[model samples]
Target: MKLSPYFHDLRSAYQAELDDLTQDSEGKDVLRKRLAEKRKEIAFLVQMMELAPEMVAVVFHQGFRFARPMALEQLLGRGVDDLPGWSSLSADGAVVLEPWAASLAKAVLAEPGGERFLAVAAGLEFMQAHSRLAPVASHAEAEEDDGDEDAPEHDDDYDALSADDAADPHNARSREEASDNWLSDVGFDRKD
Candidate 1:
């Protein structure tokens, strides 16, 4: 799987958001409670969809049931602007909300730009899953040299990018900084 740089960076942020929501100081699982709390904040979070997507996207953690990973894989290769509309995925049955998460899905979909956010949310989860589940081989990582002769001519049409080579550090750093500053302003401790 090869990820476009946009998906690559968002995956890392998405994974981190999920991890933070996974546990509390006691180390016992609190994901459910945390997610519920986040769901309550959907209106505020909806505003974050474009700027801090991973933060907003956590509301849909485990919310998707991927019926057509192939469709999602194809999506991962493109940048945000080139992404297909959400209807394309829904019409093709590429993904659907899990029964338990339907209400949250409804809430998000009801928001302005909800369709766009859902598409980005799916891409983040797809890349995160493939990154964690797949074994690391040089070939499996995101290719840095688009012009390398040895680079596979075809991406196998599967879209997922690994952190190893899937990003522009400057962009990632700026994103991180923006996220941190936002958190600080919102009264949360900045990530170290």
Candidate 2:
């Protein structure tokens, strides 16, 4: 499904914000903080969109980045129907995103402007809630691990542990506590 230009612009802005937040990070848990801030910003933008969809430009980095100013107005006026097979209007100038991102964009655009923005915000929140950063191994560490033939293979154990964790209320509560602590560290109140 084709997305409206507004949705495309919002997506680009959302991703850019995330990228910017993660670009200069150092130490662990940085992504969690940035994700929290991004969620808050998105929530505010969505609220603004809901209050005044027409007034919200949804433009990031001016019109030069995503759709041209005229093109954006034209798309807004004409709606998605006028732009079949038209997709390449993002800050990255890419017509396609990761399948998951594309699906989220399509879902958001399925709604009207304000609702679409809200959907985007909800999507961000969902992403923030579920995302876990993988540890980046240094080259030396990678080489060391590769050479460790005696290391126990724990793939099955990991799978079983995750399954057990999913079924355990104590584990779930611990995860929630960790999440709450992270949120608080990032200056956000845990949503009840």
Candidate 3:
């Protein structure tokens, strides 16, 4: 559906916020805390949409995937009166989404302006469900390691450290990133 410039801008800001949260100095996903803060910030907007869907321009970023991209484009190109209802849209747009995201979408679509809410809630829920934390190798460390590739001597201590790093609790992908990657794998741009 065509959204107002305000809503479009809001969507862009929302995606940018998520992108910013995806990485830290440690290259860890710090999205959970940030997403909670964002949910609070937009709580009122979500409420407003629930009360008045027609008045709000709800936009979802990579919220749904179309089996036929051209069909979706054609639908968008037409007038609102010609547009299909939420059920048709949802059915047509539905694809294999991550479990958390699928649940969130189902919940949001059950409410007023659920279609619109899908855009906001699905993103936050996806992020909350998929973000990860891992020890990021620094550029200097990577360069040093690259230069040492010629050394045939293998350090058992280094191998042990690598094994330890794999088992480290902090070194893992967040649920949000996994969900985001799923969307990307399905042909939707994460930032979109």
Q: Please tell me which predicted candidate would have the highest lDDT against the true structure.
A: 1
Please provide, for model 1 over 1-192, each residue's C-alpha lDDT reduced to its tens digit, 9 standing for 90 to 100: 567878776766676677678879998999999999998988778877777888998888777878998899888888888888677888889987778767766777887777878888877776665554554443455445455778776554333345663476775575567657656865889778
Tell me the deviation in Å of residue 131 in model 1. 3.6
Candidate 2 segments whose C-alpha is farther than 4 A from its true place:
25-29, 37-116, 122-192
How do the predictions measure up, each by TM-score? Answer: 0.71, 0.26, 0.37
Q: What is the lDDT for 28 in model 1?
A: 96
Candidate 3, residues 1-192, lDDT tens digits: the string is 233333332333344345556578798887666554543444344555543332122223334444553444344334323444455545655333444345444545666666644443332323222222111323334456677857444321111114465466554434346545645754778863
- Using lDDT as the measure, what is the rank order of every candidate, best first? 1, 3, 2
Model 2: per-residue Cα lDDT over 49-111, one tens digit each = 554332232221111222233343333333333433233334434222334344334443554
Task: Compute the lDDT of residue 34 as modeled in candidate 3.
Answer: 56
Clashes of 2: 0
lDDT for model 3, please: 0.42
Q: How much lDDT does each candidate structure score?
A: 0.74, 0.38, 0.42
